[model samples]
Target chain A: MSQRHAVITGAASGIGAATAKALRRKGYWITALDLNDPGPLADLWHPIDLDARPYRLPEFDLPVDVLVNAAGLPPRPTTEAKVLRVNFLALRRVTEHLLPHMKKGGAIVNVASKAGAKWRENIAQVKRLIGQANDACLDDFVSAEKIDTVRSYDLSKEAVVVWTKKMTAGLVERGLRMNSVSPAAVETPILGDFTRALGERSTRGIELTKRSGTPDEIAGVIAFLASPSSEWVRGCNIEADGGLTAILDTENTIRPD
Target chain B: MSQRHAVITGAASGIGAATAKALRRKGYWITALDLNDPGPLADLWHPIDLDARPYRLPEFDLPVDVLVNAAGLPPRPTTEAKVLRVNFLALRRVTEHLLPHMKKGGAIVNVASKAGAKWRENIAQVKRLIGQANDACLDDFVSAEKIDTVRSYDLSKEAVVVWTKKMTAGLVERGLRMNSVSPAAVETPILGDFTRALGERSTRGIELTKRSGTPDEIAGVIAFLASPSSEWVRGCNIEADGGLTAILDTENTIRPD
Candidate 1:
């Protein structure tokens, strides 16, 4: 049997890099995609900008049996235009490029965040965007509105989680699987970027979890989604935030801004 | 007190129409948006081609206090390009457009479908998209990708839900609320279109609820989000599906396709 191939985006750092290393350790051929050069991983296939590039099968050049989309940022208050373009808009671009090569038993692992819990109430607005989902000028729409960059990110993530479920319905019949993982504050080297994005006051004390999760810890969950052991898992977003989501629930306290 | 202003998309039919009537009944001046003519709600402002038009603030010469994005299609297997565009691309455009005019105690409600429950396992892809939320050309990024129309609806809704939560961190400080609603087979007049979009097999028994819910039923939940009663309900998506999602968990024994 040909070795199962896994595609990892954002592979240059944090969870993406860790996920690539872990999958490689498991004897899987790894195709790592990132804006930054993927440093010394054995048998690595790196790609230029995923958003900008034409999605060749196995986006990194090898045939991919599994795809892990692990690139993203946290939300901050800023330009609405920028946020929508990046988080949700760019994500849709990446998914389109990768779909044709996904086979039965093939799985897609989408890295969502714990913030995705609010998916049930805003039906009206979500539907509208879904209606516009067809238009090719998504950026023109945002640009015309002059939206702040920060707000667009949050909206983009919301769209990504929603699309994961939608994709599941489409992929189910094809014997392909699609699911998402939402991690709460993994202590990725990118944690600093997250910190900068979220003003100090907002991120303060929220780090009550004595230890942030390692990139490897987050990757373990991704591997599970990609493997046959998780075949039955469909459209479920596993939360791997060191029980912080549960803790926030226990307190019934909201994440303070 | 000045009456709150609301911008609603897809207001000519189904949930959009119902939500428009519901909001009007609640005494808010409605800026109803849709491709179709607004019929009798002529007194209410209607924007043609919400997806194509630039989202100018002071819509109808009034600052929008709330935004209800209730437009989209059912899930189906389609070209990957179409799926991403419909599902994620446009959603970012509308949300980013309206964020500036939204004020303290303001709320943005997005409408998603029950199909988006699969985000837990796809964390990486979600992150990559989420990362773009802050970029200057996020929506343009989507336009450049050339996604399809049908599948994009579901994916966009998923992104919408995720983005709502991400925005909470920032919006909370501004006293603005962002939330989503996911319905399971509501009895909207648009059921036929949804069924067509969802394709034949899955549509067989979709209306398994105590008869499908009316747009009014779903609208009540949306009104709640817009009211002071739900001020603390930030970043929440209430499932108004008459427990269909929960019941599906028990009734359907998922089989790997």
Candidate 2:
């Protein structure tokens, strides 16, 4: 059999970069798309801007074996529009445009944040946030919903998580699969943003299992989802955040008599 | 104290109607909103079109102690956009408009379906669907995401469940609370939708715990969320689906080696 091709966004640094390396080791050729050049592991590199306005996805060869959407904006002093666009709208655009190109038995893996763990909480506003394509529309959304950049990041990740579920049937129709890996407080360049948004004491959750996860650790989960091993794990969001959400779930459980 | 006012949406039938009657017995003056005339269970009634474009909200007397959003479109022969608009978008519009009217110690209850049981699976798309307003936009969403009407209803309820989680901080800041009840295969006007969507063989999960929940039984959960009895249950989504979800969760559990 011929070597399969894979596309990974946000492949410059962090999880995307690590996933590219991991997949390369699995004998899959990588077509990397990121804001910065994803070093030598990429069999083919597309050094495109992640925050490109109006969001036009670059063309690629058909029957791509795997698509990993690890591109995203972290919570920091940034505009909510950019956060939503890069993290969600762009992700959706890429997936929708590329759906026709995915081969049977292919898999798609998305990266979401644990900040989005409670996405089930305020879904209406988050949905509106996801639809906002430009600054004008996003401004209206942010003002109406009172969402800050940090919340925007959470909403974007939440949207990514939900989008995976939404795209399940279409993928299943074609005998393909899709899933997401939700990571929180991992050791990445964006770690400071999480520390700032959630505070250092919030590390107590991560510390529960000892320490924060390395990019390679999260990459392991992404690679698993992208592999034939997790073929039955369709439409699932695997929590790869070092048991932080599990701790929160434990706190949330208070059984009634 | 003066009688506390409560607003109930979709109060003409099903869980909304049951909740309206249940709340009236709790000494709250019911302000019922529905597409149909609520048959005398409400102290005040507003018969408005549920499909009003741009979602114009009705004026309400302030200091509402409880708000129950039980209005929804079940999976029938309907457009995906209409289902999403009625079940998710319109519900959001009402809740956002009424947030300020809620006084301290207030509580909000949203009726979500068990079809949304897998909300944790795809949160991102659920948020976007919840944000879609009209069919033109919802059509773009449905086509872009490739979501069907049944999936739309599931996404809508998933959004409701998650929306309840998202509003926790804002509600807490305002000294108010919000929660949702996810009813599964309940014997209601909409139960046929579940049967059609999931089929007859699916009830084995529901039947494991005996019969499906009655509207009154679900109303009991909604009433609990609305009253001071559940003050500590902030941002919680109560699975009032008579243990079907529990069975599914047990089936999903992968015990550690």
Candidate 3:
């Protein structure tokens, strides 16, 4: 088989770095993108900060087979506007820019959060946010909507999930597939930020699941999504969160007879 | 790493056989069970008919690390009672019987159908069906409920999905994880039977997706679910149906502003 090329954002560390290793093990040529250099783990490196406006991606000569949007800012220690922009808008900007360069049979996997699972309940807000222009003033939007830093993080992820679904038909028509993975309380560098942002909610999820998920575990799901094994799977947000979503879903829906 | 053991039902053909191959590639000792012989695929084989009133599984000295309940019956050329029995009841029976032998940190993956996606809508009927005793008269129940062959097939799978969710807490408490995979149309031997039963519904799904899924595609999902890579995922029903569920979900929920 010929070698496949994968472009992964946030490839400097955590789930993105883990995915880089996993796909490298599968013999994929990795093009790592992040604010910091991903070192020797990347076959090629591109330093791009997601928070920068006019998000410009370098033109690629090679056809990309896989694109993983794993870059994001957590709630704590980040402004609400920055969280929304880095997490949602920048992801959209990168994907749109890379679409033409991606091969027909290529796949895209977005790293969403289990906190975005409540997208259904907040559909109106999510859709409104998704409707905003990429370069729109997110600060004004956040202030007007009264979205806090924590809520901004959740809303950004929720938008990611919804946008994935919205983009599915168009991508599938072009013979490309797209999906997302939602992990709960992963033991990444951003874990402390999430703990500070979510407080008891984050701790309770880890308590229920016994431990935080390893980045390798989330990457395993992403690797599967990028491969032909998941050829028939598209526009889905896979919950890799150790039964936390399951417990919440079942408890919320199931009633005693 | 020592070779782990996996017990898979319906191992004579389709997704079950494919799962056996996938797991074997990962150095798992496969114990295959089916009415027909699985031949060379099985390290050990047990012949058992799920349609039999008293479902009996052979004893094993090995501590099972994974269980894949891939046994099922389609809507066509099968009685309602047999369809329900083989698909849902037999699955529960085998899992309960084998729970003692299954190792802690082990996983169980149930094969369900996309037809069962409306499980939430039919939760009342699903819960009632699950409430039935193991030895209850399924034929009488079908007649009383006025369920036809197709409805039986859907109901059986719905029951499987709900049962997976219902069993999650208890199983997790025991250090065991359980989940289900729902595939759309797949090009298996039973594809004809499903086509005959579902008619235009099945063909429309195939048309929308451009083609049917391969058994290997579904098996890849089952393999991931059975591995430590999916340690955090439990009680979730993964839809591996080529964006069919996603289209339905997005179209159903998203409203015109």
For model 1, residues A161-209, the per-residue Cα lDDT tens digits are 6667665555666667677777666677767656666555226425543
Where does candidate 1 stray beyond 4 Å?
A51-62, A74-83, A129-140, A143-150, A200-205, A253-257, B1-257
True contacts kept of each: 0.00, 0.00, 0.63
Candidate 1: residue A206 lDDT (0-100): 51
DockQ of 3: 0.64
How do the residues A1-257 of candidate 2 rate in per-residue lDDT, one tens digit apiece?
88988999998888898888888998999998887878797988877775765545778865699999998877766577678777887888788777888888888888887777766565566556555655446656766777786778888888786666655545656777777777767788888877777675446756654567788878877776676644444566666654455345434531110
DockQ metric for all predictions:
0.02, 0.02, 0.64
Interface root-mean-square deviation of model 3 in angstroms is: 1.5
**What lDDT tens digits, residue by residue, belong to model 3 across residues B213-249?**
8999899889989988788788888898888877766
Kindly provide the TM-score of model 3 when superposed on the true structure, using C-alpha atoms. 0.95
Q: Which ten residues in a row have the lowest lDDT in candidate 2 chain A?
A: A248-257
Highest DockQ: give the candidate number.
3
DockQ of 1: 0.02
